[model samples]
Target chain A: MNKPKPDLSVRIGGLVMQNPVMTASGTFGYGPEFARLMDLNRLGAIVVKGISLKPTQGNPTPRLVEVPGGLLNAIGLQNPGFDGFVRDYLPFLRHYRAPVIVNIWGHTINEYASIAERFNDLPGVHGLELNISCPNIKHGGIAFGTDPKMARRVITAVRARTRLPLITKLSPNVTVIAEFARIAEACGSDAVSLINSFPAMAIDIEARRPILANITGGLTGPAIHTIALKMVWETARAVKIPVIGMGGITSAREALAFIIAGASAVAVGTANFSEPLSTLAVIKGIEAYLVRHRLPSIRALVGTLETGAVIPKPRGPGRPCA
Target chain B: MLIENTIILSHRLLKGGYRLLTLKSKRIAPMVRPGQFVHLRLPSPADAVLRRPFSVFRAQAGRLAILYKTVGKGTQAMATLCAGDEINILGPLGQGFPNVRKDTLPLLVAGGYGMAALYLVAQRAPVKGIVFVGGAGADDILCADDFRRLDWDVRVATEDGSAGKKGLVTRILDAWLNKELHGRQPEFFACGPNGLLKAICKRVGRGGWDGWISMDRHMGCGLGACLACVQKVCKRDAAGRETWAWARVCTEGPVFACRDIVWD
Candidate 1:
């Protein structure tokens, strides 16, 4: 007798995915770029790079620097604005079955709302991933993601503009990630995704300057997986809205870790650069894991972490130092 | 593009720290075009996380070759690989050089290992023109013998006066264009460090010669997803209005028109 397959489908707010494996924005350039290397239809969802109100030229050369277990990138959210994306890329992406998630950013709250409203009537776009935490940009990105008030204001304004599933991507640069996650859920954001690359910088000693032309970039890959895992776990516990986990997801083991830590879905970021089929491989590996453990569905494994110890919460803001 | 683990058929050390590593891949050779490159995953012990990008120096029957210099940690690790070893590769990536008319003369320029990309162009060239190559010394003039065999006129310049003329390669090209070309304009092609490409852009812009230059940059995904390797280009819109945009070097081109490039 043939065994039945495990249920891999997952739901992120209104967006239904065939599986819980998605390609992170910026890493997976608007879908068509990786189409020749792998089948785009097989992905859980394709989150394109951040699109602005107008076309952006991005930073100058030497935009990337590879470290031991990760990459530092200051690509500056370079994308074909809202109109350019719809005209040039959306048509090709419409051919694929995967849900198209448009990751967007802007210099102002009005700009973010405007871009979101524009994609509302667009045929192929399934959701909007608000990129308020991109470390590479000069303004609006990390600034909004770090402030709870700004995060609330931006999500609230954009929520009124579009009925599309709103995903507020949180920043690790914040002091309390759970607080921000709660703010998004309170503001009517359908779901929240997080751990947009940590704000980082690499220096060239001889040149006495930064490695990236943008001076600083977002640090991502396996190097930051553990940190992301902790943040995702805390954020998931704080909100009822689903949390899409991402940051240094390279393999099924890592993706599985995020699921167990409470992420509804996982996005493969920097890994796509090294291996184009990493998402597919992770999907297969997760299925194999499910079958091996006799798990009936992917939902059965979500937030299944069993921490044996119960540490007492810290009391009072400031106690006498010993 | 296909990804496969290929066996190293041979590795030869050339002058000036350059090495030619040939891989035995029956699947890749037939698909290779001029200006296309292969992304090589080197066997590094530490810190060299990304796969190195190398231009297709030469591709022949059931084999492909990459010419690289040992300038840093990644190349240093690549230099140690011996024949019979296996290395992972993704290729014939990016758009290659555009086809030229058989009747037009083609002038080729290269500096150091930049010569690697032009040999294939020179090989399939219909009308051969002069080859200008500049290096630090005599040994740095790579693949000159290969061009001589192809019956293309080769000119050499070295900074140390170890070879033909002493000075920059752009000087040699300028002098030749003045003395030989006169009123006749030839198609130009170049690949090298940014400085070399910038020089060609200036000369080509002033002379109004039609040609392209291959660009090099630190790339993450050689398939254009990463947007890490972008070149500023003067693009034309549907209304024929000129606009400056950052184009992907991996997809739009490693080869771009000389005039299209927005040189600094």
Candidate 2:
């Protein structure tokens, strides 16, 4: 007489998420910044702002600029050190029902391992989102993420240090992103999240200078959505491990596309800045999609995109032939 | 903080291309404190992914108002909003100006539309003192009468000699400190451009008096999550050693003490 509730649970390595929706790091801050606005427990996981080995001060002022469909931010990975996060944020986050994925970054391979090692015995942390891909930072962030050999070294070093689920957040700047994903798999990374914001710039024509103090910042939001989707599709096919898709997801439609393309999960980044209730909305939308399509569970939707057999439909007059 | 689909009660253009937007937000209006702001998602600028933050000019009953100029794409888009249109707003955000101390005289300083942020500060002050406002010209000055209606002494200054005093607001303030001073300690609440705020900060530092400044920066997320609007402020440890730290302007401030700011 009744239909069953669609099962939305997803897992990234050992961490089990109630749904596939996650709050991207940097955009979500720590778990508490948004807790007052939205339920922290509702998200699949809360991927907090990146943390480093030592306390980082970030960049100078004029750190953000809004473009047509997105924004460019040069926040420069400003964050509390590993100890600072453990002491100030961990206890508060441990109380949330959703898993806490700490985004960790460093200036060197050793720093990456050291940061990972500190979180090993931490009671609250469910996983580490290795942020080798932040484009804003001058040093470790942009460097380690773009270089293939270095990406392997950093992932390997961090994998050796922490027993927690390791996620290598890959950069979109690379020519072939799948090669890096395969490297992460080889290095023992449990999952991979792609793509981080694209390296971008905005200029003030009147001032004749870059709008951001850092000149170049990472671009995120609707503009990068399609590009990120392609990268997710590529990386998903490249690795057997879970692929967490992110970049410009503002609603469930984009999240669904990610899942259909092959993402095991989706992370809401810039959308969190615009709408704090977006994660809840995305989760609800995904469930509605599942019910509408009569899919038994979210797992069934993963990599369900049909390919290689479809013909194109013709548009109205004056359009090129399909 | 709340995100509400507030309906526009009225939208009118005042002197100098400024738009005074009134919204019926039973959920958020009553929660507003002086100097707090609302981030509006403009209807036009469909490509815009960020919400623009505006200072609360007035909040009462089940309605709130923000007085802003058509400065950028976002505000220009806001000009297209009319009565009964729904607008998404996240509000009563950031810390507002603190209460005027009992023993201190409350002096309100503003620059142009900055006066909008200080109205409640003036109305709520236990004692009414002098209000000094400045702008580039008469067209740039706004809301001087609103303060006058509140029975507070209002002083005006324009750089082009088109208004009250023929120089900066600080010049008139200096004159008051010299002639009107019978040894009354004044606590200052100011909102203006960075230059005007820095000038007020200099005076606050010299007089050893308290001054609160509302800073306006390019904000990405009005909620402190984005780390887009950050101001460096001096922090002290248990040992009293001072270190400068980046405090989010969208959360820790929009209002910060003049003394704590470490200007770049």
Candidate 3:
């Protein structure tokens, strides 16, 4: 008899996926942008770009710039409104076997609730990845993802308005990310996705001007991997709900790091830009790792980090390290 | 429209840092339309930069070539690539130049290495026409002989007075419009810097003739996912109202109609 295949299935609240690798919102346009390049059915889930109630024109030219190990972008949530997305992208997404998680964002609590209510009625939407951590936008994004109170209110408002599973995408700009994770759980969030691009900026020395038209953008890529891994571990420890870890995930090793760090699932972000097939590579790599380790399922690998020999506490708090 | 690992047949560096890279591909080369580009991932110590896009300079039976100048860290690293190296490429992408119209005479315009993008157009055109090639100096002007070999009338202009006409290309184009054309309508096919494209668009609009210009933008994900390369374009609504919208340069076009573009 053939050896049994390793199970890669994972679940986050009501959303069930074939695998644990998902496309980070915005990195994977609705469904068709990358459909021609790779098989969409293989993804754990597909998170389309962020969408709002009304169509947005977005920011001006020069929306992106590259640094040593990351890319900064200030796209300002340019998207086809709900109506446009439903008319143009939904039917296409429904054709795929992968679960469709529509990433939704709004400038106000009311806007968030309103769009949430609207999407709640949509049949094809599997979940809502609430984008409160987008740093490039002028309002609503980092403002809600960073502030504990606003985060709670928006999550609560959206939770009440929509019955779909809510995955709050958190910001890394705050001092304590775990506190926000607790708030997301307290406010009825089903799961939490951590570290949406750290707020960042780059400058042109010769021109002495900001590289992006929006002045500052969000940093995403290998540069933020370690930082995001730590945050995912912290948030995972602080909450009972599944943690979806992301930020600069380029390979299977990195995705496995998130799972071992306690993320129930992982999303491929900037790496999608580098390699359109990065998600597939990550999915394949994760399976190989599981088979090598003899894990029963991906769920068995979640939060399995072995911190061998914990360091003794530093002798009291000394003079604040300068 | 497809991703393939193409083998480098040749990597040659010409003077002025311009490099011509030839790759052998069964899928990309033979299928590429004129003005389309390939998203090339050059090997580096760290994969920091996103894939770089280069318009197909020449494409034919299982082989394609890209002519690029070393201007950034990506291209600088790409220079180290040798023949027989395998590079990952997503290619033959974006809407390319449409076929020449039967009723109008074809006019080719290029700036500097922009001639690389228009070579296929000249070769594919049913009838030969005037080609306006301009640059800052003699060294900057490229590929005039290729057009001449194909029997297209090539006009060279250098701003520094180091080659051909001692002024901008507009000086020579104005002279042609004043005497050369015996009233045959001209449809322009241009690929160049924004300034040259704008100038061509202006003349085309003024003359009420058909024109297409290939656009160059700072791109990420040469796929449409990144939203990095966006160009504001005119969109027509149900009521026939002209409004503005952002079009992804990597997907919708590296080529667009002269009249449809809003310069601002």
TM-score for every candidate vs. truth? 0.95, 0.97, 0.97
The interface RMSD values of the models, given in order, are: 1.4, 0.8, 1.1
* Model 1 lDDT tens row, B49-162: 578899998899989998888988789988999999999898889888877568667888999889889988988777777789998988888889888998999999988889
Cα lDDT tens digits for candidate 1, A1-322 = 9899999999988899999999899988888778887898889999998999998878887899997788999988887788899899999999999999999899999999999999987889999999889988788998999987788889889989998999989899988888888888888888888889988889999999999988888899888999999999988877789999998887899999999999999999888887788999999999999999999999999999989988443332321111
TM-score of 1: 0.95
Q: Name the lDDT value of residue B20 in candidate 2.
A: 92
Which tens-of-lDDT digit does each residue in A134-155 have in candidate 3?
8877888889987777888898
The better candidate by TM-score, 1 or 3, is 3
Off by over 4 Å in 2: A310-322, B237-239
How do the candidates score on chain B by TM-score?
A: 0.96, 0.97, 0.96
lDDT of 3 by residue, B161-225 (tens): 99999888877887898798889999999998999999999999999999999999999998788
Two-way TM-score contest, 1 vs 2, winner: 2
Candidate 3 ranges with C-alpha deviation above 4 Å: A309-322, B237-239
Give DockQ for candidates 1 onward, in order: 0.73, 0.79, 0.75
lDDT of 3 at B135: 86
Candidate 1, superposed: residue stretches over 4 Å from native = A311-322, B45-47, B237-241
Q: What DockQ number belongs to candidate 2?
A: 0.79
